[model samples]
Target: MAASLTAFAAAASADTLFGAMEKAYVTNPTLNAARAGQRATDELVPQALSGWRPTVGVGGEVEALISTQRAVVPEADELVDAVINDEAVSGNLAIELTQPLFNGFRTVEGTKAAEARVDAGRQSLLETEQQVLFNVVQAYMDVYAFRQIVVLRKQDVAALEEQVRASNERFAVGEITRTDVAQSEARLAESKSALVDSQTNLARAVAKYIQTVGNEPGKLVYPKVVNLPKSMQMALDAAGEINPRLLAQAFVEVAANSDIGVARSGLLPSAGLLAGGQVSDPDFTEDQNENASAVFGASFSIPLYEAGLVYSQVREAKQRASQSRIQVIEIARDVRRAVVESWNAYVGLGEIIKNTRTQVSAAQLALTGVQQEYAAGTRTTLDVLDAQRELVFSQVLQVTAEKNRVVAGYQLLAAIGHLTAPRVGLKVPEYNPEENYQRVRNKWIGTSVETVE
Candidate 1:
């Protein structure tokens, strides 16, 4: 059992963390959904710019008129009456164009707002990507640790079984009492139960692994701790400066303030150029009776009053902008708190891992000594069973401590805003949100540049 445990430990040295991370980076549904969302947000820029373009339209009108007229002819001492009936058909076709010269800077401010929103969306996607990577780290560690515990439990069950057989043999030869044989049997049963529990835990971890990494976990290898900030203060500083959530909120605030500008622009005058031409045919004659007119003019409009609608909208936008600014402050506080907590857990887990390793070694030595003393008739069977149980508990603790240590490191990485595919050097094609933004920012005409899948 011990030899097989050593073999499993040796095989765990394979480096599979990057493979798991790459799988998640490329195929995770949540991350892909965020990418699609950002791509949708990218169209806001072009939609805003549409306000500056020309609008062309064609129109036609047709009508038929019927009339009756009565005429009286004057004669010498006589009166004459005449009735006349006539019908006329008229048709006209007109083409018109209008181009915006100015809209009180509304379009300018609106475009700025859209650009800010796109920036915010990019940051929001980054935040989601970071979260996915962190979840992958946790799931990977869980599977690895649980599998290790399963191995430990199996070995413990086997060892206890052998002890039980030995105790039974000694009782049959009159070398040990029936109570000794029963003690060994009870310990063996308990070990078997623990082994079952470990197996269940391992199965749960595997399920989580599938959910996170988008596939079943294969032979997993241990993950090495990535480099961290030199000090806790440095970590906090980095998080405050570059954390995705905080950056996203800052961009949202900018967008909200831009919206306030857009609302205020409603109070100013708008200017445009209009050009049109119309051709008319009356009396149903194609060339004999026809008229054509052309018109070109510059137009200006100002809202004298709107029953307080525009004013109320301006006030509402101002309040929303204020709220967004306040949210940035709140998010900054939360980020700092997260950084501090992650740092403490990271440090504390390191200490716990060291102590648990020592505990495992001591328990192993104590268990071996107790078994030897029991064979020498100096220690009772119950003493040996107790030592074995202690050893098993220490082994479980050691695995759990290692799991927490690795997870704490990942948590700190996420808190510091460096948990990204490119930052982590995951060997997969990285999705650049800026590429989509640049592709469609100034597009004049199209359904979409490309679909993000």
Candidate 2:
């Protein structure tokens, strides 16, 4: 199955937008890095969950003591040494446990905050995916347009070369001045230079295509027409509701607000249950034996004063929450602005594309008439050269306008948060960041980072 998929991908990437987008979806380094960052975020849930679970630990200690002893007989007048030296060894091994009963609902609020952050992280990953896809779209369009422009430049150079030859023939026969021939030659030189520049642009575009799509493009197929919102208001509405960055910011605000609760918990009382069992040998004396004991207790603490640290932390959290709330408003306004700008640009390019096509058609007709007039000696060499230049210029504009229209449409889609892999109809698996979050959210132990591909 993998081999077949690989073969299919190779064939598609050789000449299509879908293949390029699919390849970037699976292999782009930036997208993969963002996924990894999201997985790191998913671990926060498990860390928060640990607050509600008991902690168990095993420990052991060994000690040795040395001493010198002396005694005085009560009936005797002199003191005598009763013991020269004494040594004793003691060891203890224990297992201890603590389970939280309450801590002013800190765990509850912390878990809520963590879950909210994970939600925000998922949205952030979506935003990153959209960015990568949009970059691919722009890069692909640039290379395609430049490649077409290069072809036009080559055709222009060829036409100018023919014009120069004709001008030279006319001058040799005394039908035109040397100036006409020189003019044609100069125009040919300019066209050649333009051809070189076009080729350079094509090369640069190829390099960028490789970087963004993870493969060198073959003969690329133009991207399919995107589904656009019906009106500016509709686009704005979609962006307001679904724009990934805006949604992510909203989630961050929720997380920040939850943190206030977490911080306030520090000022309240806490309680926990503690239990332990120990096996010990207290001394090495012959009459001594090992002993075992068990202990169980509950602990409670009330906050007195700690230099006002908890109060300060609570204040800081509230301020941060306020900052986040402001950011949500800021992001919403930014989204609206982007939607408006992208909508206008895309709509304007539609008319531009139509106008450029009409210009190309008229230029082609004019060039044909000018060339016939030149053959009949009714039009000068200069007139023919001008017509050819106009035709090529119009043709170049047509190609560029088409490319820009497509790119502008893509940009508008991106602005409205609709340029997703599945939404755009790329034949690839969608990345589900939530799968990783669910996989690790309640884990208690071990360190395995393997998540869904």
Candidate 3:
């Protein structure tokens, strides 16, 4: 897995977003934490199943003591007898086994609850994965967008420099005033400053991308094309039945409902089986004696009263379960709203892109005409400078529109909980939580061990 992770990271450094996301899924600390949490929850399964299995234990103890004793005869023949006793020791070894025959269905309820908890943990992991994927997409888009801006800014600077040179030539030939040359110089300086700012933004964006994807973004690749579903309703429908937040809430409610069963089980009778053996040695006799006994018997415990504690617990669990259900409804509503908003924003940006493309084309043509007219002495220096600025503005707008469209696409995916690895064209790592649980659970089930270890 580590080798695979390294390979994926290498690919991401070449600006493969999908590969980067896969690497993050396999090695990112935040996602690993969620996987660990899921594994932790799996332990609950054994705890619940323990009630159905036999528990065995062995213990031994040894003790030694010394004492002095004195005896006195009658007064007529007064005599005293004293003796010191030492070398005293005693020890015993015993083994005990206990098996639950019944516990008011507590074992059954406990196992069910544990299963529900496992489901909840799984959903939580999925949610974490979705979040990580969303971050990767956003960061990737940011780097791409910033790179585009840098290119555009560089071009703007070059255009301004050319205008400045042309203005200087016109002034030397007595074709334009000093004021015209000064204005051209000022525009060139402004373009240089703007270029610096664009470069700075690009640097910051690269840093963010590295942080998000856990590797340097070497040559970022832009997606060749992104297809947006025609409508928000269509997108929501495509999301289908597996929204992470909703799935998590559903499992949480199941867990809470299971808690009610566990509480109710506490109010009923419980039964178990018991068996044991023991051996002992006493210092009074110089010989050690061994004794062993084994007896299988059933035991029962009936609950009479618990100061209404069980009832209270049941009521609390029920309320929590009801709250979880409400949360599911709230999440669904929020998801719908988000989908609609992102869809609208995406559509709006698409229109802007179309318009900006036309604007850029028109500005390019205008700049060409202004430069020719200026050389012909039919247009002023200010006219040429203005045309160049308009062209730069249109180019900037076009770049921004492209970036917004990418971001909106990812946001829509996130809102629908479809931003996870598989949905986003990345590979998800397979992590089986039950693998460890089965190791211990299978050995302990329907059998007795001398020691737990």
Candidate 4:
């Protein structure tokens, strides 16, 4: 187990988005907790089966006694029948068995309810896995986006500093007013402050990423480009059908419906067969005889009244089933809203990125022209400084637009429920409750954790 965890940690540090998602899929505490709860639900299956299977038990007892007896008679014929001091010991043993004959289908309904619970639990786990994967993707993209901003901010600061230097030269040569030099210096300081703010954002993103993935992301790689579906309606349609939250809600409704059957079964009679044998000895003697006997009998329990408890329970189950159905409709509406909101945000950012790219190209060309003119003494140093500042601003906008585009894509995927273990390229571990339950359910037991290779 240690080796496997170590390998997972290493893999988690390899990429910015995918790696964190994969690690969280296996190692996140919340997801593990959900899995544990689901396994607990699985035990109900065997518990329900018990109502149909035979129960057997063995028991033995031993006793010892010492006594003296005296008799008194009212007439002359009465005499001491005997006078004695004796020690006696006895032992008794028996095995008993009970099997269900009829149970008004209570056992069958219980089993069906248990199976429905198992299904609900499995869906809940899948929903939890989807949530964890979404969190990892968001954090990873946050780090990537902020890091890119930090780089662009640094470049902006550098460009502003060069602009300030050019303004100072022009002021010395009397080619431009001192006001231009002061404006340039003020802008440079603002650029420095922006760089500091960008660095702080980047640090926070990295910290969040580390917390989620359980390791620092080292030498991060760009996330693979995920192609959006052809249209927003297509994405919404796909999401409405496959979303884990919706699926989980559907299963909850199923479990609630099954509960109604279980509650109804409680109103009927139950029947079972029972058998037992026993042997007893009055005293421990040189010659001992063993006696054995067997008998089979059927028992029934009729439910006459329970102060309306069964009826109340049935009413409650029906109400819960109705509530579950309403929840499914609510979840579907919420999912649709999320799909539309995320899709719009993604498309808006894409447009900004495209426009910013064009602005950067225009600013770069303008800066080139200003540089040539300044070198030939045809333009003042202030002109060159202004052109360079515009170029730096354009570069910053382009970087921000790119980051926004990527982060929006992640959000869109999360909204659609596609951000889950298998969808995000993470392996899901298999869990078997029966195997673990059999190991500890019926025996005197202790537990220890051991590493699995």
Q: Each model's C-alpha lDDT?
A: 0.89, 0.88, 0.79, 0.76
Evaluated at residue 229, the lDDT of candidate 3 is: 63
| TM-score (all chains, Cα) for each model | 0.86, 0.89, 0.83, 0.76
lDDT of 2 by residue, 234-256 (tens): 99999999899999999999999
Q: Report the lDDT of model 3 for residue 116.
A: 84
Off by over 4 Å in 4: 1-33, 63-91, 163-186, 285-293, 362-397, 421-453
Query: Which regions of candidate 2 fall more than 4 Å away from where they truly are?
Result: 1-14, 64-87, 284-287, 376-380, 451-453
Model 2: residue 162 alpha-carbon error in angstroms: 1.6
Q: Write model 4 residue lDDT over 1-453, tens digit each, in one string.
A: 999999788766667566567677777787778777766776677777777788899999998888887655445776546566778788888889999877767777777777777776776777777677766766777677677777877887787788778777878998778887887888788878888998998888888877777887675656754756779998898888877777778877887787888888788888888998887666658455656677778788999997999999999999999999999999899988988988998899889988888999999999999889877878766687678778777877887677667767766777777766556555555444345445533433244422222
lDDT for 257 in candidate 1 is 94
Off-target runs (Cα >4 Å) in candidate 3 are: 1-14, 70-83, 165-186, 224-231, 288-296, 376-382, 424-453
Ranking by lDDT: 1, 2, 3, 4
Please list the Cα RMSD from the true structure of every candidate, rounded to 1 decimal place: 5.2, 5.0, 6.3, 7.3
Q: lDDT at 207 for candidate 3?
A: 85
Of candidate 1, the 10-residue stretch with the lowest lDDT total is: 444-453
Inter-residue clash pairs, candidate 3: none
Clashing pairs in 4: 1-452
Write the residue-wise lDDT of candidate 1 on 1-453 in tens digits: 999998888677553877888888888899998899899999999899989999899999999998999999777878889788988889999999999999988999999999999999998999999999888888899899989999999998988989999998889999999988988998888888888988998899889889988788887777787868889999998998889999999999999999998998889899999999999898675578888999999999999998899899999999999999999999999999999998999899888888888998999999999988988999988998899888889888988988888888878888889898888787788898888888887788677357655
